[model samples]
Target: MTQSPSPTLPGSRAQTLASAESLVSAYEKAGYTRAHPGILQLAEPFLDLSGEDIRARMFLTSGRSGEELCLRPDFTIPVSRDYLTSEVAGRPHGYCYLGPVFRDRGALPGEFLQAGIESFGRSDKAAADAETLALGLEATAHFGMDTPDIRMGDVGLFVAMVRALDLAPAWKQRLIKDFSRKASLAQDLDRLSLATANGRPDYQGVLAALTGSDPKAAHALITDLLSIAGISAVGGRSIGEIADRFLEQSALDASATLPPYTRSLIERFFSISSDPLEASATMRSLAHDAGIVLTPTLDLFDARNAEIARRGIDLKRITFSSSFGRGMDYYTGFVFELRDGTGEEPLVAGGRYDDLLTRLGAPEPIPAVGFSVWIERLAGGAS
Candidate 1:
C-alpha cells in the first residue's frame, strides 16, 4: 500500500489555489494550456541539465524492485518527457504545469508548487524567449507585487568570447562552466597559471585548474615562470606549454576585465531600461564596439533585443542588465530573473535551454525556455 498523505500536506501555504489560478491564467494568456496532473520523471535527466549543484540538493530513492527514482524536483523535465512520448510531436505544443515538486530540504522544500510553461517544436527562438520572459513578468504583475527588476545575460555569448580567444578546448570548457562564480573562477585561473609555471605533468590538468579566471598578468607570470623552469630541464610541462597557458590565461582575464572604453561599451549594453527599443540599440552599439564583427552570437543578442522591441514591451520597466547571469549550466541563451527590488532573492528565473532538449534525448531538438516563480518566496514577499 502507498503511504498516506499527512494532514499538513493538504494545508501547505505553498499550494494555495488562488496563486495556482493566477499562474495558470497568465500561462494561458501566453498560449500555454493546463498540462494536467503530470507524470513522474527520472531524476537523472533533470539533474543532468541542472548540473552538480542541483544534483546535490535532490531527494532520491529506490523502488522495492531496486530501481532508482527521485521525487520530482521540477515540472519541465516531466512535461518535456510527455511531449516527446505523446502525439504532441510534428506540431507546436505549449504546456503549463502546476503541482507539487519535491526537493530534499531547505527552509520549506519537502513539497512546493511549481508553475511553468514549455513550448516544444518552436522555431522562433528569440520570440519564444521574449514571450516566456513576458509571461513571468505578467504573473508577477498579477500578484500585485512591486514591479519586477529584470536583467538578462547570454551564456552562449560568454562562451563564444572564450572560444574566440583561441584558448585550449579543455580550458574553454572549464571557464564556461565556472563563469558564474567570480571568486572560484579567479582561483581556478591562478592555480592553472601556477601549475603551468611549475612544469606540471598534464597541460590539461593545469588548464582545468585555471577554469575560473581570465587574467593577463597571471598568464604572463605563468609563461615567465615556465620558461625559467623549462630552461632548467624540469618536468613534463614544456616552455611552449607554459607560454601558451600564460598568453591564454592573460588574454582570457584581459577580455573579462576589459579596458575602460571597452568596459564602458559593455556597461552600456547592461543599461537597457524599460524601453525595449532603446535597449536594442544599446546592445547593438556595445556588440559593435566589442569588435564582435565575425561573431553571430552578438548578432543573436541584437535580434532578440529587436524582437523584444517589436513586441511593444516596455524595456525601461525591464532592465537589460548584461551581468544578469542565471548561474545554471543549461541556459544557452537569453537568461533573465525577476526580483522584487526589495533587495530580496529573485522570485522567478528562466532562460532558453536549446541544448538541453538534445541533451535530454528528445526525439528532435526543441528550442525551449521558461521560468519558475518560487511560490514560497512569493508568499513570503506577499506576507
Candidate 2:
C-alpha cells in the first residue's frame, strides 16, 4: 500500500508570502534596514552563546575543516553578531529579516520562515520595550490577527526579586537558574525543603572526591570504582556521560539547602500574578506583605507598562503572569509572548537581550530588543 501525501498547511503559499512581506514591510517602515545574513551559521555560538532552549534543537553539521556548524536557527543571533562585527558596532540601528530556519520541530516542519526586527543600542529603555511590544502586536494585526493573547513577563523583575530575597547562597543560585521553568521551581523548592531538614550525609564524601583533587586521579578512581561494581555506560550513553551525570547528581546531593523561611519567601513571590495594568500594585503589595523591598526594577516595570500604553496598545489585551518566563537565558529584561487562541504556541515572541552583543564579542554592552513573527502562526493567531 502507498502512503498518503501530507495535507497542505493553513494559508496558501501565496498568502504566507504576502503575510511575510507585510511583516518585513511593517518593520522596515518602522526604521529597520533590510538585512539577510544567510543560512549556515557557526554552531559553537548557538551552543555557547544562545540559550539552552535552542541548543538541543539545532540541526548541526560539520564543515570541510571539521568545524561544527548548524543551519540558522534564528536571525536574531546572526544579525546581532553581524552588527557587532560591522562598522555600526555600537551605534543605534533597527534590523529586519525574513528567512528560513532549521531545527528539530518533532511533528512540525523542520524548515519554516520567520520574520523579525531587532532594535539595537537604544538607550531609552521604555521606548525600546514599548516599540518592540507594539511592533509585534501591529505586525500580528497587519496579518489580520485580532485580539492576540499578549502575555508579558519580566526576567529582570524575577531576577530582582531573587536578589531582594534573603536566602542561603545555594538556594539563591538554584532558584535563579531554575526560575525559567515554572514546574521545576516547585520540584526544586520541594527538594530544598527536604534536603534542608536533613543535612547531606554524603557531603564529606563529595568534598573529598572533588576538592584538593587532581582531576586525573579522581577520574581514574571513579573509573576503577565503577568498573569494580560492574557499572558502565548503558542505554546508548557513553561512559563519560554516565560519569558526568553521577558527578552532577553527587554535587546536588552535596549542596546545602535553604531554611524553611527562605523557601516560603520564594513560594510567595511565585504566587504573585495579576493584570498588566495593576502589576505594580500587585508586586508592591507582595513586597509589603513579605517585608522585602523590591528595588527600582519594579518601578522600571511600571514605567515600561505605562510607556506601552502610551504607544496606544490596549492593556486589556495583555496579561502579566509572574510565572511566565522565556526559556532563552539571554533575555536580560522585559520578556513577552503573543499568542492566538487558535494556536498551540505564541505567534510572536521576543524580549530585551541586552547582553547578547557582549557575548558575541562586542567591546561594550548594546541595549537591544526585538521580536520574531512566526509566519505559520500569524493567521492562526489572528483567528
Candidate 3:
C-alpha cells in the first residue's frame, strides 16, 4: 500500500515562507551572514554525528557513485561544513539559514521550513551562550511569543557529574552515552544500583568468559568468531562495532554494580529543576555535600546565567532541568527549547555543540552554538 501524504500546518505556504524570511532577517541583523547549503548532503556525517534518534528519521538516498546521501535533516551540520571550507575557517563566524529540512515524521509533514543561526569559533563561551539564547528568544518574539516557556539543560554539567562519580570507566561512558535517552539512562541507573540486571541470557557464557579479559583480545576473538560463522555484519553494524559491543557488554557484566552512594548522587543531580540561579546554587550545594567537585561546571553555568541576566532577560522565565536533553547527541552544553505556554512541542530549539566541527574534519575543536525556529509551528501559533 502507498503511504499517505504528510500533513501541513494550518496556514498558507506563502505566509510560512514570509515568517521564515522575517526570522532570517532578524538573525542577519544580529550579525549572522545568510547561508544556503545544498539540499543534498553526505549521509555519513549526519548518520555519525546526529545520534540514533535522528538517524532513524533521516530520508536517505544514494548518489550516482553509490556514496550514501540524504536530504539535509538540519542546517547545523551543513552550515558547519560550509564554514570549514571557507577561507576564514577556524576563525570566529556566524551564519543564519532559512530553508526546508527533510525527515520522516510519520503523520506529520516530512519536509518543513526551518530558520536559525550558528555561531562558531567563539572563545567567550558564556557570552556566546547568552547571545544564542537571546537570539532564540528574539526569534520567538518575532512570532509574538514574548514570554514563551523556556526549558533548559546543560550536557556539560551532566558529564561533570558522571565523571566525578566513583564508577568503572566503561560504566561512566555508558551513563554518559545514555543521558539523551531518559528510559535507558534510568535503566542504567537501576542496573548500577543492583535493582536490576540486564544481559542476553543466551550470551551469558560468552559474556562471562569475556569478562575481565583484555579488550583488544576480546574484540579480536569476537571478530574471529563472526568470521568463522560467516557473519560479516548484522543490522548495518560493522564487524568492528559488533566486536566493540561485545567488549562493552563484557565490561558491564564484570562491573555489575556501583557504590550505593554513587547512584544516590546521580539521582539527586538529575532531580534538580528550578530557575537557572536557584538550580546553580542547588547543584553547587549538592556537589559540596557529596564531596564531589562540580565547581567548574557550576561556575560556568553561573557565568552564563549572569550574562543572560545582564542582557535583561528575566531568570524566572527559564526553567533549568538537570535531566533535560535535546535527544541529539552532539549538544555538548546549554540546550534549550521554547514553547508557547506549556505546549508539548517547542517552536524553537537549539544548543551548543563544540566538538561537532572537529568531528566534521576541522583540524581542531571549535566552540559552536545555535538554535532553529520551526516556521510552521510559529505561524500556526501566531496571533
What TM-score against the true fold does each predicted structure earn? 0.71, 0.85, 0.91
Which stretches of model 1 miss by more than 4 angstroms?
1-15, 37-40, 195-294, 381-383
lDDT digits (tens) for residues 147-252 of candidate 3:
8888999999999988988777888889988889989998888776662344345666777788877878888999999999998889988899998887887778
Off by over 4 Å in 2: 1-11, 168-170, 208-255, 380-383
Q: Which residue pairs collide in model 3, if any? A: none
* RMSD to truth, every model: 9.2, 5.3, 4.6
The lDDT of model 1 is: 0.64
Which residue runs does candidate 3 get wrong by more than 4 Å? 1-11, 195-217, 381-383
Which stretch of 10 consecutive residues in model 2 shows the poorest summed lDDT?
1-10
* RMSD after Cα superposition, model 1: 9.2
In order, candidate lDDTs are: 0.64, 0.78, 0.86
In candidate 2 the C-alpha lDDT for residue 320 amounts to 87
Cα lDDT of candidate 3 equals 0.86
lDDT of 1 by residue, 1-383 (tens): 11223446556553455666666777777678677633455666766677555676678877777766787776767776676677875367788776677766667547765677777777888778878777887767766675777767777766665565444565566667776665665665665565445543435455545555555555656767766664623355556565665556644443232234533443354454444456456655655666664257766766777677677666666665444566567777788888878755677788877777777676567777777777666666331
Highest lDDT against the true fold, candidate:
3
**Better candidate number, 1 or 2, judged by lDDT:** 2
Q: What would the per-residue lDDT of candidate 2 be over residues 203-234, giving only the tens digit for each residue?
A: 55865366445656766677777788887777
Give each model's clash number.
15, 1, 0
